[model samples]
Target: MTSPQSRKVSEPDAVKLPREIKVLVAAAFLIAIGFGIVAPVLPQFAQSFDVSVAAAAVVVSAFAFTRLVFAPLSGWLVERMGERRTYILGILIVGASSAACAFAGNYWQLLLFRGLGGIGSTMFTVAAMGLLIRMAPPKARGRVSSLYSGSFLLGNIAGPAVGGLLAGLGMQLPFLVYAAALLLVAILVATFLPAAIPVPVHERGQAALKKNILPLREALGLPAYRAVLTSGFANGWSAFGIRMALVPLFATAALGAGPEVAGISLAVFAIGTGVALTFSGKLADTWGRKPMILSGLAVNGVAMGVLGFTGNEFWFFLVSAIAGLGSGLMGPAQQATVADVIGNDRSGGKVLATFQMSSDLGAIIGPIAAGFLVDEFSYGVAFLMATAVAAVSFLFWLPAKDPHP
Candidate 1:
């Protein structure tokens, strides 16, 4: 198999992108904004339906479940329809579903709409990534990946504050705001995005769909691809799941901080992540991916260990910052590594879809596992478990060489 670098040498035109890259990145920013607007409010909205905390969490879990199931299929759809059309359709679906979510009268209704939103998200996300990998040059891939990751982090940072403010207006107000954002996203996508020429009719009509389903073994056999998936899983597990599960509980119960204090702690952690990512992409490009991945895992391990011991609010925030920094360092490397592995193959779409599925899977599993450990033992046990997972990821990186090299 040709390496991504070698492929770049052979086909120079593959590195030269059309002007649509900016539009795709803008779509990513908009999607993140929509998601962020809902994240902080969804649980409260679910609870208004008289659901339990775990049940309310199902609102999130349902979204992940649908994304996990549909992500791979999205690749096939993008191949059949072309990237631009798929992206526009996805954003429209998300907008419509989010709008419906605002009017949902029952828990099941909300769950249904959120699941639909997840399907939309999967299509948009996979197609956008395919566009990015196809358009960016290998030399600039790291920076592009970092900027892509940062856009979402920026959205995340802004979303919660916005969501909190909107929540003050009414419980359903945030959903309305998210719907509006999605509408804007859909409009931007449709207006600014040019059509991605479909593969030749003969090429796509018979061969494309058949080629869409890359065997899991074959996909996983690619070392760089596997590494990115592993890193993505570790990231989502630690960053999204475990952090959300442990941080607030630890702040409120162990540190005796009020809700406002705990919320600020979370915000500070996200700020650290966003700030660290600003430079992390450039570092990965200059220093190479291995050091960034290994060092990030190590920092994440130490940060989790620190959280296991610290009960002070300030200390908790400090440890969270370290963990966020670790995530910032790793996230861009993981994305670039995926492109490195898949290169310019049409498989880029499927490869990224599979890679992203791992994160979704980890997001689904991490909190449940951590919550069980916490319930069975203590929050200390949960943090220790997270530390162990980080440690395992570090070990995974030890023998792993960067394929991009």
Candidate 2:
């Protein structure tokens, strides 16, 4: 097949976004909504099967674990099929899996279905990010990242609140709804998202090969890429691993707050992240990426560490919001830096996938590690440990060069 237009120019020179990027953003919105619909119910649903807390937790990690294992394959597929097809297939798999989860009669069945869904999650996530870096111009890359992430966050904001209500109806109901939502998303993405224009034949062999496998050897040599790996890990550990796994429990046990309080704290965090996104992208575009990356790591480390010391709900809420804002500050810059390092290439699939893998690994490990600490020592100790992880990530940034500069 002939490559269309080949994006003959670098994104920094392009005046507007490609059609597929916009469509992908819309698809992200739909998928996030479904994820949100399931988020509030997944654990509770697992518990309903009379499983242990650890077993219930497995229902959650199984997805991330599989995603971690299969991310490389997802990168390979995106290189071969192009982002559009890969994305649609990923969504379809997730939808099918979610629907199967709704009917799962045993704990093992639920676990298996969730694991299946994780494989699909890796496919769409890596493919979509790869597509974004391929298309977004350097000057506007930050803003584009913000918009795409913002769409997902906005969906998350709406999803949990609705998911809570749906759970009240029945635990299985949310899964069915999530499945249906994903199905709809797949259909929309397939219809509206255009095929990526092929690279020129002269560049095809190398580009296609790169898409299938990552340029690990070359990427590792770049300080900027190293920094991205560091930031991705810290972000997942502090932002998601701790926040999702420990925050609610901390709110309930330490602060004496109800479930509603945890929800509010998370909402506050999301709000801060959203507000920061409004200008974070523009700042990254103008100020350079390293400064943003460094500041975000430092601020998040401070915020995370403080979580262990807070005694009241107000303080807990405030710190959570601060951490979220730190994430906001770094999110666009982090993704933009990766895009800059890859520098308009398809062979970047492996690089990007590896970058994504670092974060997913953190997300998988962070909670388990923190939970172990909490069990062995205390919540405060767990929080402090997570803080140190963030600090190490910041230090990694110290010597790293900014590709945008």
Candidate 3:
């Protein structure tokens, strides 16, 4: 029996998202769906050129390699061109690259085209991060990050199924479909996303816009930022690197399962992640980013540590889902922490790019290191190493200041 004013103060904002956020989320969904469409077919398409397995693998790696290499330049573009223009340009570049990939006359042509698309990928990715930071309310950054990430996750889940069906028609069809989807996203953003709102000059007469741009070195000096970088790397290592590369092989080798079972386990992991995403954002907003991030790292770490020891399918899937839950629980919080550090008024494309690089670097290195461990020692050792990496990240956060308070 609270009064209306008091009741209002206690309640959360309406569930509705801002129009700008909605547009971006929709754009994210389409972009994810398009990427998903291309993924299932890319390796197979390369193989169709009568290349060896290693060569086909190279085609897959080329995209990631280019992304890593071009990330800094993408950050520069975000600063120079403004988020809206950079985003639209990036979409068009990727769309054009996709179209080019569809019509590649040889293996090298496909490889080159795919690599070009990676440049565009980083461009849009950095711009999107900047836009989200600028537009999301300080209190609601966690929710916004979750929504943005969830759209991508859902699209990724749906994309492969559609890609698989499209493959029956032709390997190149998926690329064309993906290209068309990117075009749609570009048009949508161009039509709906407004230009940047101008900032007022500071009290001392310094240009507010210049003050808003956060330099990379300055960001690196913040303990919270440093802690976030570690978590980003660990998350990339375990979630993107190990999960994608090793899980399927582990299922087949250890559990004597088929490809179908591996697929099911992976899907279940995503299901776990989706369930966590439903509530993690709200928790991050209310409870603070630090607790959620640490908890997530611990849960994910333990789940991974035990993953290699599962004796059968039931245990395997259970741990996989648990690991996914851990990852999901932290995803929003990790993002919100970065947002907190950058604040809503400041431009942080460089900071965001560096953060992304940590993850990307981990993704590149984790599988290679884990694979070596598997070859020399065992799967147990490999997974344990992943656990160790996560632990190190947790420790890094221990002494760092929490941005929430």
Which regions of candidate 3 are displaced past 4 Å? 1-16, 198-211
> Positional deviation of 89 in candidate 3, in angstroms?
1.2
Candidate numbers sorted by lDDT from highest down: 3, 2, 1
Per-residue CA lDDT of model 1 for 1-405, tens digit only, reads 889889765442334434556666666677787688888889989999988998998888888899999998887777778667787788888888988999998999999999999998899888777767656666656777877888887787778778888889987888888878878877887777666432322244553344343445676787666666777788788888778777887788888888877778777778778877888777776677778887777787678767867967778888888888888888777777876675543555677788889888877788888889877988888887777877777777777777654
Residue 102, candidate 2: Cα error in Å is: 1.2
lDDT of 2 at 135: 71
TM-score of 1: 0.88
* Best candidate according to lDDT: 3
| TM-score-better candidate, 2 vs 3 | 3
Predicted candidate 2 versus true structure: per-residue lDDT over 1-405, tens digit per residue: 445454534333344766767877887888898899998799998998999998998898899899999998987787778777787788889998999999999999999999999999988898788778777766778888888999999998888888989988999999999989888888787777566543323344563435443477888999889878988999999887888878888889888889999888888888878988888877887788888888888888888889877999888889988989999999999999988887555546677789989998888788889889989999989999877988888888888877884
TM-score list, all predictions: 0.88, 0.90, 0.95
Task: Kindly report which residue pairs in candidate 1 clash with one another.
Answer: none
Clash pairs (backbone) in predicted model 2:
11-137, 210-347, 214-350
Models, CA RMSD each: 5.3, 5.4, 2.6
Give Cα-based local distance difference scores for all models. 0.76, 0.84, 0.87
| The candidate that achieves the highest TM-score relative to the unseen native structure | 3
Please give the lDDT score at residue 297 for candidate 2.
Answer: 85
Judge candidate 1 against the unseen true structure and give its global Cα lDDT, from 0 to 1: 0.76
* lDDT score of residue 355 within candidate 1: 84
